[model samples]
Target: MQDAILDVKNLSIRYNGASEDAVRGVSFTLGRERLGIVGESGSGKSTVGRALLRLLPGARVTADRLRFEDVDLLDLSEREMLKVRGRRMSMILQDPKFSLNPIQRVGAQVAETYLRHFPANKAEARAKTLEMLAAVRIRDPERVHDLYPHEISGGMGQRVMIAMMLLADPDLVIADEPTSALDVTVRLQVLNILDGLVRDRGIGLIMISHDLNLVRNFCDRVLIMYAGRVVETLDARDMDAAEHPYTRGLLAAQPRIGGTRGPLAVLDRRPEWKEGSTP
Candidate 1:
């Protein structure tokens, strides 16, 4: 943790007039490694990621400590946050169709990040954009750069999103369900590209996902969330050894190859599970 890029402690978020918190007392430190957050829908996994980036609108975010590198994110004004957002940290959204501009060419959108952060000439930004497109394993970077978001396949769009987010070489990247929209083969390809970037650049990655199997295979550590709290944290390889009943139920619910066919087990909800416990 001495080389931690992001340190979050006692983080919680709630929308105005909401009866309960969406995320409560979640705490973790991220180093230059892949960390996965997994849970069912409405389990507050994405909310935690949004809170780290201050992307949740009209929501009250509070934390005893939420520091990215040397900067305190909670204290920075909205104007100042703009500088930190794409330069030091970036987010890859769930769907590129919604995140990317429909009208703008792909290369232009990628170059926009470079132009915003650095005082580079137009020619220089274009060169960097092409270089990044190639880095993400896009076939024929020159041809793909000229295509619009709609013209490319889902897999290519996600890779473009990765290329855009990593244009400035951020220290921490929060990817929220980045591969959820792709097919199996494409999903693995996208994961490979993301993994390569994180490893080669030594950047911290927070992958918010609902796929337990993918996280177990792709991430270094996993955080099991329930309701609004982190119920358990363990090495991704040791997910099968999870002690919490909620975690156990999730593993049971997953369909296994060559296993007996039966109805998936339902997660038995418990009130005590939301009592803000940490592991």
Candidate 2:
């Protein structure tokens, strides 16, 4: 972990007046590799991502240690955290419609991040914005650049979001259900772009999703989360060898291409499973 870009330990988050923490005792280190967090909805996977970026408004977040590079995120004020958000670290949200400005042109939105973080003039930012759009494999970047978010398709919008978030070449990128909006073909394309970013630039990536198969195929490491805690963490290729019952159950529940054409096995809920127990 000496070269880890992000180190989080005992991180927890709770919304106002919540009976229990939304995220509990999550700890993991992200190096320059793709780390996927997999769990069902409301499993605190997204909460962990938001907590890292300090984006959980009106929520109490605490951690024994939360460091990005050499900077301690927990100690930084909101104003100081702004300096780190887009330049040093960035997040790709699940949906582009909610993440992007409906009124602004896609090119302007992408250029805005580069302009905000770097001392680039309008022309320079625009050039870099078009370059990034092309980097994400968007055809005719010129036309897409001037189109509004509503004018683009879901896949294109997601690509625009990706272009904007990565314009600054952040050291860490947290993607929450990044490819969920695209078709299988577009999903692979987007995944390839993310893979290239990590492989070529050495940027750490945290990919949050419920797709076990996708994570196993695309990521270097996988963290299995249940309820509010991480039940297990293992190499992506070793996911089938996961010892935790929750992870094993999840793997079994997935319908295989040539497997029996029967109803998927139901996940048996166990009270003790939520106690942060890991086999």
Candidate 3:
């Protein structure tokens, strides 16, 4: 895409002492679009997300070209990368329990991002925090602001986490199974909030998830990964047209409510699929 904000080409990553790369030759470009990456456990979904932000401390992350906007992400110094994180880019982690500070009040933690990137006073930061909390559809932002992380419900915590990451108006947002811990209603609510941000704010989104149905209905494009590589890429509405055997197997494995009453399909892994796919 000519308007691409992120370009990743020939990317591969391997942890120290590992014989093979955990993520092998992953390549894709992100415009102001919602791109979904779906795969089973250990298929390098989250690994790819962390690799982009250079969060894999012990892993060797390599790419021929990994550029975010005008900057080369792979070549940046850690100190320089820190400037990009939160201000230019943000990551909404999987669970609120782990992502949020247990002891910090909700408002202070959300306000920290605003204070870190901008020259803002405490009162200004608090206003922005409360505004963002309300923006995410939280009721009674003033009361929730002073509450500790442990004081909120799981669904509310997800909203607070979204607010904290988005408080600075980042250009790119990486959500790693962001709603895995929520119920059906809360999941849709959180997804709607993300959809609005991508639509209204024009921020590029990469949603790393295992739920095919979620990505099918939510994302614009879908990347199907198997054995640490993207096996197929297609429009989310065209998942049924996937050509890869692994992709087909995944589609077959998901049980439908009113469809067949027979047993769900089991994936038959093949070693040939371990090789990297051509871009």
Candidate 4:
């Protein structure tokens, strides 16, 4: 079995001035493989992802245990956490437009990201950046290198974001709806790039998305979340065997291609589950 790359235990987070916890006693383990997290918006899915990286600002984070590679994340000082963030663990946000600097050339930004974590010379970093851009299937890496973020299409920008993150050579990547804003074709292309990255690099991935079909096809294991907690987890191959009502409801909501159906099934809305109750 692959070794555990992340271990979260009784983790909780509450934003400042919020009456309710965004995440509550959430716990799970990640191995060196793909683990998909599926939940609708406002389900604290993104909160969990940010919390893992200690990226939640103006929020209180608490956990009995949060470990990565036997290192206790909760115990690390901010200075120490800085060393871990981009080097050992990285995240790709939904939109690269907001993530990438508008003024900087894409290539320079990517190279800078690499240099932040590694002691490589300028020539080495630039070469590595070009290679990463090519790895993400960007056409004409040499030309694209000098282009600013605004000069690129949405898909190209996203690819640049991926190239930057990958340059850190992170062991684990948290991709939070990484393709949510892209067109259908671009979405697939990005997914393919991500697929190759995981396969070739042997890095673990936590793909957080509400797209059931994508998760079903791409992930090795899946976690179904509602309200701030995991309601079910199953092997991707056994997703059809999901036992929770919420999981079934979600699956039923997806329209099958080439099949005529009535209005999409509506999910039953319950009051968000309290922390002490069953998910």
**Whole-model lDDT per candidate:** 0.92, 0.90, 0.91, 0.88
Clashes (backbone N, CA, C under 3 Å), per candidate, total: 0, 0, 0, 0
Model 2 stretches with alpha carbons more than 4 Å out = none
RMSD of each: 1.3, 1.2, 1.4, 1.7
Of candidates 3 and 2, the better by TM-score:
3
What's model 2's overall lDDT?
0.90
Show the colliding residue pairs in model 3. Answer: none
| Order by TM-score, highest first | 3, 1, 2, 4
What lDDT tens digits, residue by residue, belong to model 2 across residues 168-274?
98999999999886788878877887788667888888999999988999899999898889989999999878898889999989999999999998789789888
Model 2, position 49, has a per-residue lDDT of 91
The residue ranges of model 3 lying beyond 4 angstroms of the native Cα positions read 276-279
TM-score result, candidate 2:
0.97
Writing each residue's lDDT as its tens digit, candidate 1 over 1-279 gives 888899999999998889999988899999998999999999899999888889988999999999999999999999999999999999999888888999999999999999999999999999999999999999899999899999999999999999999999999999999999899999999999999998999989999999998899889999999988899999999999998889999999898999788888887878888784632
Model 3, span 226-270: residue lDDT tens: 778888899999989888888889989988889788988998988
Q: Clashing residue pairs, candidate 1?
A: none
Q: Where does candidate 3 have its weakest 10-residue lDDT segment? A: 270-279
Question: Residue 53 error for model 4, in Å?
Answer: 1.0
Error of 2 at 52 (Å): 0.4
